[model samples]
Target: MIAGGERTLNVVCVKWGDKYPAYYVNRLYSGVTRYLDRPFSFHCFTDNGDDIDPRVRLHDLPVEPFESELQAAMQRKGRKGAWRKISLFRPGLGGMEGQILGFDLDVVITGRLEPLVDAAPDKVAMRHEWRYEWKGQPGGHGSVFVFDPALHRYLYNDFAADPVGSVERNKGSEQYYTSMSAFRRGQLHYLPGSMVCSFKYDAARIPPLNLMMEPRLPLDCRVMCFHGSPKMEEAVEGFEAGLLRSTRPASWLKRHWRV
Candidate 1:
């Protein structure tokens, strides 16, 4: 709430290294602009801002005491782990106030975003790890998250206090640490699965069937997450890493993943 009692949404993303280029951020801004039907400010925290959209508020990647070690750990896993994103959990992130909605650059927005914002307005919310839902595992997927910086400052404080120890205990997974920390305090909720889905698991057909039929976007999904293989680029054209991990060209993905 501001001077006029008007509340604005704060949409944020991070581009720490060269894994994704500037276009990823630019197109993400375009998607949010097209879908979110409310007043909002878009922000990007990155190591390089050379070619990003000018309308996006850019800030240098926030630093932490163990950033160097965190970076090293991420590299060890081929950059699959996003340890630096923990920095965003810090209070006053980019000096902005209010509830924050975050997306990984690899996600493709497909439907209305308001539902996601309204899902868990006060408590910290994230997508339940889809892969482990069947096992009754409790943890969050980092792709999409929403929280108030004021209330969730402890997320960063705890990590900063024991970065290395936390990494070792969580098996170098930031999302694991984040989800369990909030869950233990009874302040964590999972966004509806139909809204945010894994591109590989939910959208694409399983295995051999994928070879014959192109991936189909789930009818009710709002954001499709490309966590591992066949990222937006590879999926748009087509990708075939192997029998188990593969996808045919997704025309719908091509239609939405653009600036």
Candidate 2:
């Protein structure tokens, strides 16, 4: 309970390896403090907690029995592995009950995040993959998600029962597996695209135009996601994403992406 006896909003993020430092967690916590108006608890499920802010709660990453086999399969297929995210669906995660709002470490909070917290607050919600949405493809980006652990444990249960088989059937994609799981049960809800825009796909202009113009924030964007390349740090300094996808320095990021 909060000062006014309101429910505490639990905002979560995952950090598994050395790829992202402790500052990433700090930066996200800082953003939450600035943008979220209500009482909230920020949680980080990570393997390493060194240097993370004390105010931010820390929990160990869930270790599935077949995690090694799952990674081996992903490597064999030459697919990027983000399988650990699925573990968040485990029952009673961190002994946390009720609904949780999660974000990828690579995202930048641009405005009031209350809408995201309120949108489908009781269901499993995420931004539909930007590349697949227009083509009528079914894929969840998994960058942002909201779900109650107690209600969604099946996502982890089924996967754990046959981790390797699940990987192969889903072509080693965790997002697709997660998306399809909720989708099949008619439980998947999509966050509005206007609120959760992608940096590379939505904000950056088309190829030739991108070379000439700086990437602009989409109208009504609340969370700017850097999923594939040109992470927040790289975008801030201007990353040359080859000839077709180059990005000028996004000066605006310095304002919100901080610790």
Candidate 3:
């Protein structure tokens, strides 16, 4: 529990359809509680909240007022329909105030979240998106991000103003819009590469000897992001197979799941 004058932080995750099962959400909630230090609240914004655990607060999906022609263009196979999640950008859906961290259901919490929350307030913090670099610089990935609700109203307004143009220009990438907005506003800050690293890129960087030998947890990494290729199930399998390890190793993740 947080003591007096210590601002409370809220974490949110979105579950749209059957793509992500209840168990995955449950595991994510459990993982966060086990790792995050400061007082926090975990909330799930979902279309269907049935079978969701009692511990996790559930909020209804924002409804679209009317069908617009732009909806047709936003449709894509295997992707969560864009409009369904547009409400999150709306003002006051979750009563979210202060600093908030949003994580996708696919992520795993491996260490304390204070570093992310404690990041400079002037800039919005996120991981680099690309694998390889043009120069010596790293890119920003939007999978995990920390933002101040009071300051980032533009993220929502931009989407609302030109839903079609905004989504199309950004290639329907949410993180891209986030980074671009922050960049335009001069409020973007890149988190250390190790904090929100991709399993695909970093795993390949490990020496061949290290790969063939026993898996050693990354020393500096605070959170290991399983972004594109490997899903959580495969990640769990690889960890068991010694192909993967965390900065904070857990013997039995199942046991530590409950808050």
Q: What local lDDT does model 1 show for residue 237?
A: 82
Ranking by lDDT: 1, 2, 3
Model 3 lDDT tens row, 65-123: 42373465467543232345445555566876677787777676766777877776657
> Ten-residue segment with the worst summed lDDT in candidate 2?
72-81
For model 1, which pairs clash? none
Displacement of the residue 145 alpha carbon in candidate 1, Å: 0.4
Question: Which lDDT tens digits does candidate 1 get at residues 102-160?
Answer: 99999999999999999988898998997668889899898999998788888888877
| Candidate 2 residue runs with Cα over 4 Å from true position | 2-6
In model 3, the runs with Cα more than 4 Å from the true position are 1-6, 64-70, 76-86, 132-139, 204-216, 239-259
By summed lDDT, the worst window of 10 consecutive residues in model 1 runs over: 71-80
How high is each candidate's TM-score? 0.93, 0.93, 0.80
| Per-residue C-alpha lDDT of model 2 across residues 1-259, encoded as one tens digit per residue | 6676566778899998799999989998999899999878888999899999999999998877888987777778456558888777886678766778888898999988889888886678888987789899887888888888778787888998988788887867888888888888888889899999898888777878887787898779989999889899888888886878888888788998987
**Each candidate structure's count of clashing pairs:** 0, 0, 6
Q: Which candidate achieves the best lDDT against the true structure?
A: 1
